[model samples]
Target: MRNLLILLVFFATSFGFSQELNCNVVVNAQLTGNENLQIYKTLEKQLTEFVNKTQWTKRKFKPQERIDCNIVINVTGQSGENFEASVQVQSSRPVFGSTYTTPVYNVNDKDFSFNYLEFQNLTYNENQYESNLISVLAFHINMVLGLDAESFSKEGGDPYFKQAQRIVNYSQQENFKGWKLEDGLQSKFALIDNILSPTFSDFRTVMYNYHRKGMDIMSTNDKDAKNEIALSLAYFRKMNANRPNSYLTRVFFDAKAEEIEQIFSSGPSVDVTTLIDLLNRVAPTHASKWRNIKF
Candidate 1:
């Protein structure tokens, strides 16, 4: 009977592990223009590296995972000063015993220009330009989707469809002016507002207060205090879900919750100084709490 119970436990654990969604990604590039094919190849290589090298938290994915995705880049039009590119991203993931497939993103633009000389005539100074473009794109995607180190490290497990929705929403916004990109890098807050459905700033007040008084309350063994902190965390997470680039909130919640949980589990033996420091780190937004915190 004991052997059977252990075997069952092992099998259950293995089954649960196997059920985790896995993913792979393939990139397809098609360039149309008098431009050098080498340039397209370089772009392809850069993009591939970008996707592959990105770390998405702790959930790193293997190429042969159950989830699969593809990125198709079509350079459909080109003229001396006008260059057009279209990106169609497709993704598939298993959910609740069913496989869901969808277009993650379909964006086509004609005004963007890429100089072959940029790559071919590469100089140290020009490297910054390329880096800026890559950073902008990466930041945009990261904000549009709450991608962390775990998601980017995987192949198909990356949440591309959610990101697509953010892109669509941002594009439809009245304030969305393509001209803004011309002004150099946009503010992170603006990016968050643009891509997220709910404005992140809406929770700023609550989050700030939580950081101040909430942590101290959570340190107490009082059940009511713990529940209050939990409720606050839940609310913050929900609000963050409504906006792009709110992943930082998620991270903050995780860190704060873990600290609170540790204190609870350790009882009075836990280091109060450490807990205080953690609260202080998160208290910048809640000036009142910061001022009121005693020790």
Candidate 2:
């Protein structure tokens, strides 16, 4: 198992319509024995540009309209040009009619092992594996866009999801660690697969409700917003029952747990006890966190 260190840094930059992600990329190799940090610094600069300047979607976005996400690469060891590391990816969007930003995706993947040459440009081709570093970064970027799209509209993320699946399919030819079918449940393969599966359609619907109907309306109508969120919880419970220990299911709650707890704890109209029982059933792994929600 690789040691993971997540350092989140936010970058606010003004850009014209083509850009879609306002991503912050950090490369930390303090734990590694190599004293020269210039290589890591170069990697960080290129990775940041790779994510932020890339025009990911056909639709245009203003500077402020871009999605916010963080990518942290923790270099654990190195043998010459080969670097062993893990990556933490997280993304969030602003809630409508409110100052709050809601987290939509979070994952710490430990299969990152790649070679880097200082000052080398990161290049990617959709149909080919240019580099393992670029492939992994591209895979997560598409997933972030896909999840953000699903939050706003029902199955609105289909195109992005399809693109991510394509990356997975083409990436199979590469001699990488995280792109294989049997890489376990929390693998990158399983995450995108679960999101695109018809059996997991209800989970997508709940995402729409949780963000659009619930978070978007919370400022103007707390009661109705809480009710909408509660209704979505039923769908979450249903998905959990149908597919136990789903990777997407775990991802969903990982992003929403703190927000959900705060909403119910602060909203007077919500039945905290009923929600406690429902949460326990659907997300038992988060039982300790749910215990903090009071009646």
Candidate 3:
């Protein structure tokens, strides 16, 4: 009996250790020429604060665990108009390592631009420069690190998207009128509304319905299947507005509702087969939840 007890203790310890996150991150920064050093410094400082303040899962990274990161500010012209900022981050998992790099442009008009890989025409107003950058960086890092990419994407991909959606959703509300800009304000709201309007809503509804139907088919007429499908269908119908025909939309929508119906119908429980199959269909080029999702 003592020997069996010792074996149990050992197994428990090993399992606990395996669940702990053991990874290192690093940050670095560099600037070119005699451009606005102050701007670059501010960017670096903000980026650092953003990462530190972010809750990267629970105990996934240690404060002392050397996060080697850098920012390079390059001045292509004598004037500051030709300035650009780039951020690169290196993160390691127990079984894999990855690198993510992104470049953000700050133009003379105080406008900003960044690439989202698939969609690149991202533009932000002068007043919202910092906020936009933070939103973009957070989205990029979350997507690359295999975090809740689907949730983030559904929530308009970042804070800016959510903010824009809110303004549109509550345009008739008393406070939203105050959100108007001094110039071309109508055009701005029009663009935002165009992206999140009825057509977009319909697309999301279709994806949600497809997913629910797939789940219903797989669940073998389980009583909870209907409720589970209803919940997921409702969520995506409200959330996904911009990504029509996206692989994320397809794979997630294609999942067997029956497989997930029980999990969603009951309390939280991991559905390993559903998750693995979804990841296999949408990993690498698109998004991945391999490290984060578990049974």
Candidate 4:
């Protein structure tokens, strides 16, 4: 009877606490001071564990359902415990019916500065600002999940975005460097706020169609899939016309510019010139890529 109970316990433990993210954290310390290089190693290990182990949502994710993401931090300066760095956060989702994984969220955050002690515990409370280290990580983790959810369903990531906003709101009290509304338009607060605004709601729908309805069906019907994606480009034009050069617009281009070039490269059924004109209008930063897509 004791052996039977132990077997049941092991099985339950194995499946009980499934996390939602398989996140990789890398701290590039080549530019930092050598006196404390070992601490950066410790930071990388602890951060990886903290992100991968923490259950961000109550939903139990199977091993295969975990969102794939990477957070790379480039340490530029350090003074004792305080460090200044830039972070590039990226996440991708598997194309439905295809082996390709499409990039969803990719943004470079330049205002990440935090203080840390070697091997310190990383704990996060939604309502409190415990540490800038956890605040920055928590904020981006939620954003990744939120953006992934948006790709799967319309307005599906509202809860996660709200949670990210709550973190930003609570962190403002601590007077953190990157948590204020008045910070530059590219700050974390502005990013989340832009996502939650009603004017940008259509862009979320565009994301869903681009991934689920568009890319997912390309294997079976490449022409129709490309047409569906081309239809979605009008949404970008509308978004940009509504709010010219918004942060979210830039975020979309940052994530999809390369993919856009790939999708339209082979003279898709949709008018290539119209798409290029729209791309130039909506995402001028990638106009060169769009011009190359011209047939």
Query: Per model, how many backbone clashes are there?
Result: 14, 0, 20, 0
Q: Which residue pairs show backbone clashes in model 2?
A: none
Note the residue pairs that clash in candidate 4.
Answer: none
Candidate 4 stretches greater than 4 Å from native: 33-36
lDDT of 1 by residue, 1-295 (tens): 9999999999776544432122232323344634455656676666655554444223434444433444555666655423355444333322122242212222222223333332432221211233323333443344223322222232221354244334434433333233244423233333344333345443434443343334434434445444444444444544534543343453344334434444345433422444444444443343334343332
| Winning model by TM-score | 4
**Candidate 3, which ten residues in sequence have the lowest lDDT sum?**
101-110
Q: Stretches of candidate 1 above 4 Å error?
A: 1-36, 56-68, 76-84, 102-106, 109-111, 115-133, 143-194, 197-295
Clashes of 2: 0
Query: Across residues 91-152, which tens digit of lDDT does each residue of candidate 4 receive?
Result: 99889887899999998999899999998888877778888888888999899999899889
lDDT of 1: 0.39
Q: What is the C-alpha lDDT of each candidate?
A: 0.39, 0.85, 0.35, 0.87
> RMSD to native for every prediction?
17.2, 8.6, 15.7, 1.5
- Provide the lDDT at 210 for model 1: 42
Rank list by lDDT: 4, 2, 1, 3
TM values, all candidates: 0.34, 0.91, 0.28, 0.96
- In candidate 3, position 140 carries an lDDT of 32
* lDDT against true structure, model 3: 0.35
Point out where model 3 deviates above 4 Å: 1-39, 42-79, 86-195, 199-269, 282-288, 291-294
